[model samples]
Target chain A: MNRYVKLVNFELGRFMKVYIALIGITIISQLAAVIVVSKSYLNNANQAMNVDHMAIETFIEQYGRMSFNDVTNSIFFIGPIALCIVTLLIYSLFIWYRDWFGKNTFIYRLLMLPTARLNVYLAKASAIFLFVLGLVGLQILLLPLERMILQWMVPIDLRWDLSINEMIRNFDRLGIMLPYSIAEFAIHYGIGFMAVIVLFTIIMFERCYRLKGILLGIGYGALALIVFFLPVFVQEFMLYNYFYPEELFMLMLVTGLLVTAGSIWMSNHLLTRKIRV
Target chain B: MIEVKDITKKFGRKQVLRGVTFTAAKGEITCLIGINGVGKTTILNAIMALTPINSGQILIDGAKINKKSYEKITFIPDAITMLPQMTIGQSMQFMQDFYESWNQERATELLGFFKLKPEEKISSLSKGNTAKVNLLLGLALDVDYLLMDEPFSGIDIFSREQIAEVFTSHLVEDRGVIITTHEINDIEHLIDQVILLDDGIVVKAFNSEEIRENEGKSVVDVMREVYQQ
Candidate 1:
């Protein structure tokens, strides 16, 4: 196997325990959300028909039927996803800092590895990407199971059925994570990957220069963002919306690639030449 | 041969190494003697390329250090570099996974020599044992050059003796070894060359045997004369 792949596997193994816990939390919370939301809706229906002595048709007219949309809106449903995202974002910085600040100076061993130092940086980025994708895949798999639980809890007449597609499309956050089209998914995640790479470069700067490097890292990150958005700035202000939407998108894509390449090159230089352990 | 030519380093406004120059030949043990905070460890770190030098060059066999230089030269820092949570076996396995130069046979032999258990977690080890494990990891690597920083610092007498025994053993034979230490009594006779560092420069570099034979002075006597002056 390639050393980079081995490094990725090693990085993943280090975080395996926390990653498993995140998956477990997402599963249990999302499933509980479906059951809880469905049961409460049923209780409301029973109260309307029996306690109020209202007809079933009158009760149905007054209260809308329950669907996966209700469960998706709850904290129990979105909270775990938010937790996973936050954990991963924190992990991006932790992955590098841990080697330096852990019980021992493992950064020494990492830098001493008989391979290009960039492999260490790239391997960490790959691990974070894998973790994010893995969680997204888990969410996709859990949706149908959650829907099944909802169907089992709420009676047929009292509930509105929605396919997995409808459930995801109805939830704005879920739609962002699991885009309907492959192109949108690629574009969304490509930008996400670029952000992560830039963040890693910033981390490299900090590691190289310590206190002064912190400001340098932040400055580099801001510069990258400005460069990435330059096309939109030019299109809106200087050209007065002269470029078509597709042309603007193309220009942004070029800028994004440029920034991503620049970050990687800078990180490589820092790792190989300027890094301190 | 490892040639460090007039290397200078600065930490903030403090200059740590000021045009330090020295060379250690293959099959010879070169001891860098300095008091506390005299850039002994810094020189070793420079040779391994762990820290960048501001000016001058370090060449291993006439070429500069690179990724491949790691396979040829390894540094055993004052402390173990493996994660404390890792067991001795897992730490060794990690080294094997990364370095093609890792010698499992020598590693196992060192484990027995140090009376260390593979199942033992690094965090659980005593200070002496941890140092032993650190030395074991570096000694097991089939590298031509080995740079050790303060190997005997803050260790028990027995552990120090056990570690000193490694120098005479085949594990270090034919390898270029550079060790930094303020306390030189234990291995005074073992080292072939001595580089005395003071205020970040090589005050004296000489063959130990020649100094003893010609000057009629022990390394300690020479140290007293040079430092007192």
Candidate 2:
């Protein structure tokens, strides 16, 4: 177990500089989101008279009640776009062309540490998990800023009472205190997002062959289709439309762990057979 | 010490290594030589626990070399295989963090000796320089056994000489070193043992001193005789 930690630390250490840059980008993006949302809230608040408080509150609630489908679509769309752009700029242009990214030899070189391949996989997976968690934490921090942005955008007549601290206090009331611990509502969604990456990291080894890359992408789509409707398929597709937050978190965590396991399992299994570079 | 028994590996019905068996003693250099596609690299990879054998057992110091054995052995392939997106410095740091045997000071000194800039990405290095880095990595490891595949291929004569000197400086007693290469002239003086591999079978295994004393021939000559049968 201790050896595993060292391997993971080393795995993450390889990308420490890049991770630092990633965190900076995340902070900046969250700050922007906060500003944008806060301005929008403020603008809407200015238009409403005192008598229309209830009406405006209703409006905000109705508008903000984004369905799971909405959130999933919004978040997943960001996944590929963000990843591609970042990888292209950071890795393809700077690392690939320059030959600085050692991931091309990740399996043969990096994974061959004086430890188990399972441990190596877990370490890298942990680093990615932490990377995504850091972004979510920053996003949570920017919530009040977003509220401020909303007000700035609309200049509503209603008086502002909630400071960023109060809103965060409400979050604490909701559950959990540490920045690392996400809102209960978000743990599933965030973990699911990460699980997809874990699965890809393992299956992406197929990139050694052009055909395999396409096949893996398609495979990802297929697995997503199955995971999306798994509850429906197991219990009853029509009745199980809604997801329980705790249940969802549990399911997402399990699937993430399984896929994480599968990723290492597949990598180790396939490597035993001598796959492509 | 290492021993392999009843090992067979087939790649899609093509039997590359068929029921091959061999033993390598501690603190001795065991050179495996064979023609291309004859499973020379496969055997080395298998022994190093990089590749899995179809049906066999590999024992290292009486303990099987499995995921458990990985923490002790380091395999250096024939080519300079590293993440092209890293500097020699970053690579050294990574190795140092993971392996107990990694010596950072030796790594830095060797990097300087090779004239490779720490900032230079591996992609920019010439093939010879790449090979130098690969050898540098192997030499910097403070391990019990070092397995190198074709360490001298494609390297310039002068660089090979320098690398040889580096290896000589780093070689410690009771620390096994196994290197495979067809370029016998480059490493002829350094080898202590010869394990002649032909058609994936160990036809001859000799102590270098004994061969030189009794047979009165270099490894190249002895290698020719072992394969002649």
Candidate 3:
């Protein structure tokens, strides 16, 4: 096997325990959310018929609907999703810091490996990508499972059935997460992965310089962010009459590639030159 | 031979190494002796390119150090560099994965020599055992040069004696070895050359036999003369 592939697998193994926990939490919570929402709708109907002394037809008329929105809006459903996002964000930083600040200094061993030092950076970035993809894929798979649970709990007439696409379009966060078309999906995730690469670069800068590098790293990150969005800002203000949508996308694509390449180059340099142990 | 030419390093405003220069030849043990905070470890780190030097060059066999040159040299740092979560066997496997020079038979033999179990977790090992494991990792590699930073620092006397024994054994026979220590009582007889460092400067560097024959001074006597002054 290639060394880079081995390194990526090694990096993945390091984060596997927490990644599995995140998946387990998301699955359990989403299922519980579907059941809880269903029971609430049933309980409301029963209360209206028995406690309020209303007729069955009237009770059905008052509270006779359960929708995907009902389940999605619940705390149980949103909580796990939010947790996964927050956990992944924190983990991105932890992944780098842990090698330096862990009980034993693992950075020494990593930096001294017999391969190009950049493999460490690439391996770590790949692990982060894999983790994000794993979560996004899990959430996509879970939607249908949650839908099935909803169907099983509520009667056919009381449920507002919707396909996975419809459910995604209806939710703001889900829409952003699972884009409608393959092109949109690629654009969104490609930009997201680029952002991750840039973040990893900044983290490397901090690792190399220690206390003094923190501000420098933040400045570098800010600069990269501004450069990435420069085309959009220019199109809005300066180039409003000049470029078409395709042209603007081309500009964005070129800028994204430049930033990604620059970040990877800088990361490799820091890993080789300035990193302290 | 490994040559370090006029290396200078500073952390913040504090200069740690100032124009430090030295060489370690094949089949010789070069001992860098200094009090604490005298750039002994920094020199070893610089040689291995473990840490960056502000200014200088380190050459191995007349060529600049690079990824491939690392195949010819190995550094065993004082601290346990292996992942604390991994067992000794796993750490060995990790080394075997990355290093072409890793010898599994030698590693297995060293494990027995050190009396360390393959299944022992690095975090769970005693301080002496952890140091032994660090030493074993470097010694088991088929490299021409070995750099060790304070290998005997803070270990038990028995463990130190065990480590001292490895120096005399065939495990270290044909390699150029650079070792740093403030505590040098145990391995005094094992060193071929002694470099005395004081305040980030090499006050004296001489072959052990040359100093003994010329001045009739033991390493300890010279250390007292340099440090006491």
Interface root-mean-square deviation, each candidate = 1.0, 3.7, 1.2
TM-score of each: 0.98, 0.69, 0.97
Sort the predicted structures by TM-score, highest score first.
Answer: 1, 3, 2
Q: Which residue pairs show backbone clashes in model 3?
A: none
User: Which runs in model 3 stand beyond 4 Å of their true positions?
Assistant: A50-64
Local error of candidate 3 at residue B171 (angstroms) = 0.7
Model 1 residue B144 CA deviation (Å) reads 0.2
Per-residue lDDT of model 2, residues B1-229, tens digit only: 7787868887656888877787777777777777667787887778876665778887788887655455566778876656777788777876777667788887888888888888889878887888888878777887777788887777788888877786566444577777787667766777787777777677777777788899798888887777676
Which candidate's TM-score is highest?
1
For this target, which candidate reaches the highest lDDT against the unseen true structure? 1
For A1-277, candidate 3 gives per-residue lDDT tens digits of 8789999999999989988999999999999999998998888867886798878677667765678988888999999989988988898899888988856878888888888989888898889989988889999999999999889888886778999999999888888889999999998888988988999988988888887788888999998988888899998898784888898899999999889999999988888887777
Question: How many Å off is the CA of B186 in candidate 1?
Answer: 1.5
Candidate 3 or 1, higher lDDT:
1
What does candidate 1 score on TM? 0.98
- Best candidate according to DockQ: 1
Worst 10 residues of 1 chain B by lDDT: B42-51
Model 2 lDDT, residue A260, Cα: 49
Model 2: docking quality category: acceptable
